[model samples]
Target chain A: DVKVTQSSRYLVKRTGEKVFLECVQDMDHENMFWYRQDPGLGLRLIYFSYDVKMKEKGDIPEGYSVSREKKERFSLILESASTNQTSMYLCASSAGTSGTQETQYFGPGTRLLVL
Target chain B: AQSVSQHNHHVILSEAASLELGCNYSYGGTVNLFWYVQYPGQHLQLLLKYFSGDPLVKGIKGFEAEFIKSKFSFNLRKPSVQWSDTAEYFCAVNALSNYQLIWGAGTKLIIKP
Candidate 1:
């Protein structure tokens, strides 16, 4: 089965601290995405990578950045974590190209708490 | 702009009761639709998806959705819901531009035994 994994299930970070959230997928998919889930707000894309060393900004990329040095791993970075940034982070991967195999599979997610 | 909307903020149903969750999208052109579920503390799982052909799509756990193009709606339904079905469900959309999904706020469903 295809598996997507995130490094943390729960994370606590002090305000103004830099935070890193890591995600890895075993499917060797070409597209990886980062999203944040919040109460009353649907999942908002933070960043996405279509290929190794390639990245694109999603709708809500403000205050966030991402890295995809390798095809299977994608990292989301918070330059300066803030209370408002505390939310559930999800990582997803899919076959970057078109065709019937474009469904995205997601990791369990990381719940981040900034205080 | 392109976006998705889930009308129900919350819903409560008894086990064996019918279920329906409304999802609408503002994007008119070619688009992909999806329904996803998140059981507390678990990752979001795809309930179903609609790409081309047959507007009606069935997914795991007996969940089904109909994509009404004229209405711009994709509503999820299950003939009978179970207590185990309690979770938050999301409606998502991505224009033909690729897989950049725009998600709805989500509906919290609580099924009572």
Candidate 2:
């Protein structure tokens, strides 16, 4: 079985603070993704990394960035956290061998509250 | 633009009732379809997926979904739903060679015991 773990399950931060959410996968997958999930909005991709030091912006990447210094770890960084950024953050990893048909395994989401 | 559409936002049903959730995509080409479920306080999990070969695919928890290429739809179905089946269902699609998956708004299913 594949295991994806997040650094924090719940977090609270003041406005304008810098926040970091970490994710690690044991499956040695080559693709990692960060997404924010909101009610009615579903999951919006923040950023994705295909390889170490390689990153790509998704549909909604404003105010957020990502780091992939290692294959197992991917981190999501909020440059300046705002109340609008308060939502559930999800991290997913997938084996890139199958192209777009690959199934992504997800971690327990980090619910961030920006006050 | 590639997109996914779920017909219902919320669905309330009693236990043992039949279930059917509609999902459609607006992509023209070979695509992969998926239905994911999020139970209360649980991480999102894949319920079923359709890539090719069989149009009808069965998944865990007695859930199944059928892909209709002509209709551009992959609707989830269950003969009988339990109270434990209550969860938020999301439909997603990804076209061939695309890196991102287009997602639907999701349907919150509440099964009454």
Top model by lDDT, which number?
2
For each candidate, report its DockQ versus the true two-chain complex: 0.63, 0.84
Model 2: per-residue Cα lDDT over A46-80, one tens digit each: 99999999999999999998999999999999999
- Which candidate has the top score in DockQ? 2
- Alpha carbon lDDT at A6, candidate 2: 100
Please name the candidate that would achieve the greatest TM-score relative to the true structure.
2
Query: What is candidate 2's TM-score against the reference?
Result: 0.98
Residues B71-96, candidate 2, lDDT per residue (tens digit)?
99999999999999999999999899
Residue pairs clashing, model 2: none
lDDT of 2 at B77: 99
Compared with the true structure, all predictions reach lDDT values of 0.92, 0.95
Of all native A–B interface contacts, model 1 reproduces a fraction of 0.59
Misplaced by over 4 Å in model 1 are: A99-101
